[model samples]
Target: MKHWIHNKLAKVPAGIVIAALATAWALGAVLNEHGMARQDRHEVVRMTEKMKTVCVGRFLLDLPKEAQITFSTPRIDGFTVVIFPETLDEFQTRLAEREALIKAKPDRLGGDRNLEVAKEVRGDGGMTGKLLVHSRAVKEGTASNGLEIERYRHEGVAVEALMHGNGVSVNLASDFYFPDMVGNVLKLAVKLVPNPENKVPAEPGFCMDGAYLRDPLTADQLEQITMFARLPSNPDIRFLLILAAGLQPDKDGLIERDAATKSQFSPTERMRFSRLRAAPRTIGGIYGEEVVKRVHELNDSIVYSFWWEVAGTTDNIFVPHIVFQMDTGEGDHGPVPSSLSEGAAMGMWDRISSSIRVRPTQPPERVAAESPPTPLGSYAWAGERCPESGWWQCSDGGNGIGVLGGQRQYIRKGERMPQALLLPPQTLWEKLRGVQPSFESKTQTSWKLVDKRSRKRVPSPLPLAQATPVAAAGITSAGTGPSVMEQQGVAVGSFAATGLPCPASGWWLCDDPRALDGTRWFARGSLLPPATFALPPGGFSRSANSAKSIERRGAWRLVRLADAPEQAASDDNGKLA
Candidate 1:
C-alpha cells in the first residue's frame, strides 16, 4: 500500500498532486460531517418516537396539556403514589434489562397476565383484589396464584401483580372499595406532630389487613382526594396492626427486653387490670400467646393494649405480635365511636385476628414466564420516585428538585411505636361514674375509701410516713426510685400489716393522691434498710401497743398487709415493733 501511494504520487506533477490530495482531503471531511449530522438526526428522531404524551389521569397527562400538572402538594414521607408519564416506557425498557440480569429468579407470571394487569393500572387509578370482603381467606396463597386469577373481558383480573424489586408481588386487584386501607399504609409513614400529651419519638412501623366494604363511599371526587385533618365518617375500615417481637426466653421463661410500651400509669391514666395477664389465645385458627392491659386516658376515655404472639411464625421468636387498636365509642377527639358497632367491632377483631396469618409458602418450582407495571422491582428508577429516595437530577423528566422544593422530607416512619394503645367503649360510662374495680374483690368501687375521720366516701389525706429500712433486693442499685420487680416478703401479724386487697389506684405509693391517707400517714417512697429501721427497733415493745398498722414492704412498697415489717416475736401477747 505504501509503495502504491509513492508510485501514484511520483506519476503526478508536484503542484497537481498536492492540489489533488488537498481536494480529496477536503471532500472526505465534508462526507464525514454529513454522516455525523445524519446520525445525530436519527438519534433525535428515535428518542422522540420512544416518548409520547401518556394519559395518566383525568385532567392530568404527561408533557402537560397547555402547562398543567397533577400531584400531591407538600408530599408526605414514606407514602407516595405518583404515576409519572415516563414510568411505563422506562419500566418496559428496564424490565427487559432486569430479566436478563436476574439469575436466581422466582416463578414468573404469564405474559398475558402481565399485559392485562399493566393495562388495568393505566386505565384504572389503582387496583385491589377480590378477597376484599372475604376476611376469612388466607392471603399468602391467594396472592401467589397469578395466572390462575380469572380475568374478565369487561373488567380487570380478580388478582393482579406488579414487579417490586426482586420480589414478584401478587395483589388482589379490586375497585378499592376498602380505601381506608390507606390509613394503615399511610400511618406506617405518617408523621405524628409533636404532642405535649404523648412523647413518641417517631412514627411506628405497622401493617394493615384491609377488608373491602361491600358498599363503599362512591364519591368520585373523594376517591383521589384525602382529608388531612381527620378520617371520614367511615373510611374503609382496617386493622392498623403493629407486630412486636419477643426476645429469647430467660431462666424464668420471661423475655426480658425493653418494652418501650406506652406509659399506662400516668397520673391521669386509669388502670383497669391489677397485673399483667399471660393468657392463652387462639386467634384466626392460629393458636399462640396473649397479654391484655387496659387503661383510661386523660379524658376518661378507655383504651387497652392487646399483644398476641401467633404460634409457628418463626423459631427465633417466641411470639411475634399482631397488635391492634380497638376503640369502643368515639374517643375524646374523634367524631366516630368506631367504624363498626360494638358487636361489629368485636366481630371484626376476632375475625381479623383469626385471619392473621404467616406469609404462605410458594408452590413447587416450575418454568416461569414474564409478567407487568415495572414487571419486577420496587418503584420506578427515577422520575416520581426519585424525590422519596433523595435521588435528584436523575431521569428524563426529573431532578425532582422543583417538586421537592428546598425542604426534603426525612423519613421516620416504619419505626415501631414501641407500644400501641387501644380503648374499649364501655369505659366512658365507667369514667363518668368515677369508679374503679378493686383488685381484691374484682368489683366496682370508689376511688376513695370511706374516710375514717370524715365519715365520707372520699380520699383521706395521710401524713408522710418516716423512711423505713429496705431489704437488699428491694433497694435498686441507685435507689433513685422503685423498680418494677423488686420484692421482699415481710412477716408480721395481721394487726400491724397493711391492707391486703389493693385499692383501685393499683399502687400503694406515697405520691399517689388516691392512696394517701388524708396526710395523716402514708407509705414510704425511699427507705434505708430493714435492720436500720428496726433500731434494732424496739420490737415486741412494752405491751398494750396492740394497734397493728399496715406496713408496706419492698422498694415498690406494695400496699398490702400481706406481710408486716420485720419485728421481734410477741413474747406471749401481741407487741408492736
Candidate 2:
C-alpha cells in the first residue's frame, strides 16, 4: 500500500510539496520567537535555582544568583559610592564594622543620626518590587574608578559587578547588572532618528533625557525622559532597564514644592503621560507611599520605575527607594509595547521586593579585625543648617560653602562631614594633594587643609586660602603668609591686634547692621564682640564694612570659633583671616 501511494503521489507537483515544506519552517520560527509559554517555562526554571541574598541592616533581599550585585553607601546630599570587600571574610568583616559604626555613635560626624539608623529598622507593611537608580549627578563618579567587583551566590549561578560606596554617610546607590539571557532579561536602547526637517544635536550624553527625575511630576507633566542610548536599529526587540536603589527624604508628597518646575521633554514626543493615585502598598511590613508616575509620553515606548522607602521612627531617617525606567518601541515611530507586560513587569518587580526579609546575612566566619577609619577630604559649611539639622536642613542647594571631592560646593555653616563625598572620600584627598590623604605640606600659604592626622594639603598659589589652625592664631598681615581675606582682595585686620577674628573654621560674612545679617560664623560661646562694622573681604588696602554703625570704618569685629579651636593647627602659619 505504501509503495502504491508513493508511486501515485510521485505524479504530484514538486512546487506544491516544496512550498508546503517552506511554510512549515517559517511558521516554526515565528512560534519559537514569540511563544510566551516557552518563556514562562524558562522563568520557572530560573525561580527553581537558588537566590543570592544580601542584607541592608533592616531589609534583606533574595535575588537570582545569576543577577549581578552592586551595593553602595547611603548619602544625604547626594548619592554615595560604597566599597565592597573582595574576599568573603572581608565582606563579612566590613559589613559588621558598618553595622557597629552606625550603632557606635549613629551621628559620628554631623550627618543625620536618624537616617543612619533607618536601615536596621524594619518596615511595617508588606513588600513591593525590584529596581535600581541613577537619579541625580551626585558625582559619585569619584569612587567609580578601579572599583572591585562584589560577588554573591546561592547555588551554581553567580553574578559579579562593581560596587561604589563611602563610609561617611548612610545613603548609597546600588547597581545590579544581569547578563543577556533568553529566559529572563532583555536589552533596550534609546536613539534619535534625525528628523527630515531638523537635525539632532551631536552632543554626547547631554540630552535632557534623565534630568527630569530631579523635578516634580505635576499635573500633565511632559518631560524629555530618554533611556541611556539612542534607540537601536531594530525596534522589535524589547528594551531592558538597569535598577538603582537608594534613599531620599520622604517629603510627604512627591518631592513637590508650591510652584511647578519647568518641564524637560523632547520635541518629538511633544507631551508626557502620567497616572498617580494613593496606592498605599506594603513591602516587608513597611508602610510607605507607592507613588507610580510615568514621566514620558504614552506614545513613546517606555516603562517607568519608582519606589519609596518605608517611613521610619525619626524624621532624621531617609527612606529607601527603587527607580527602574525603560522605553520599548514596535517601530521607529509609535508607542512601543514593552516586551514584558504590565503584570509580568510588576511580578518581576515584586519578585525582588517581596523577597525582602528582616534577617541578618551570614558574614564570613572569623571576620577580619576592623580597620581604623581614614580621614580623606576637607569640607566646610556654606548654608545655614548642617546635615545634623535632619529634615529641617534644606539640601536644595549644597551644605553651606563646602569644599571636597575635587569640587567646591556650598555646605551648611557648622556642617562638617569629611566623609560625605565617599564616592571614595579619597577623591577629594587626591584633589588637594597627591594620593597621600594624610600627607602634610610645609608650604607657608593661606590655601592649605590640615586634617586631624596632622596631614596638610597646600596647592600652588591660587585664589583659595591655605589651611589655618583652629586656634585664635594671629594673621601677620605684614608677614609673607597671606590671609584668606587678603587672597580674596580684602583684609580683616584685628582692631585689638591681639588675634585674628576668624579661626580655622571661622568664616567672615558680609553683615547688615539693621537686620544684623552678614556672612559670620560664630560658635556657641566666644569672647570676640560682634563688630557693627566689618571690613569687606578682599585684598584691597582699606575698605569699610558695609554697615550703618557709627563705629569708624576699618574697625572690624573678631569672634572666635569655639568649636574650631579643637582642630589642630597646621605647622605652617596657614591663615584664614
Quote each prediction's TM-score.
0.22, 0.25
lDDT by residue for model 2 (1-577), tens:
9998887788576767898999999999889766765675455445426666543322345555554433323221122223222444444465556445534542324444312111111111111111111111111222323577544442111111111112111112322222121101100001111111111222221112111011111111111111122123323323222222232334654323211222343454434545433365666665555544444545545654444344333221212333222233344565555554443444444566566544433443554585333221221222222322111111111223222332222232245433222122347758777663332111100111222222222232212222233343344322223354345443343332112343222433323353232334333212233334323445344445433232222222433222233332222212221
Q: How close is candidate 2 to the true structure, as a TM-score?
A: 0.25
Count clashing pairs, candidate 2: 71
lDDT at position 234, candidate 1: 32
Off by over 4 Å in 1: 1-86, 90-238, 242-268, 272-278, 284-287, 292-295, 302-305, 310-344, 359-577
lDDT per residue for candidate 1 within 98-205, as digits (tens), equals: 334332232234222222111111101122111111111122322325667643322112221222211111232232223223222211111112121211112221
C-alpha RMSD in Å of predicted model 1 compared with the true structure: 33.2
User: Which 10-residue window of candidate 1 scores lowest in summed lDDT?
Assistant: 441-450
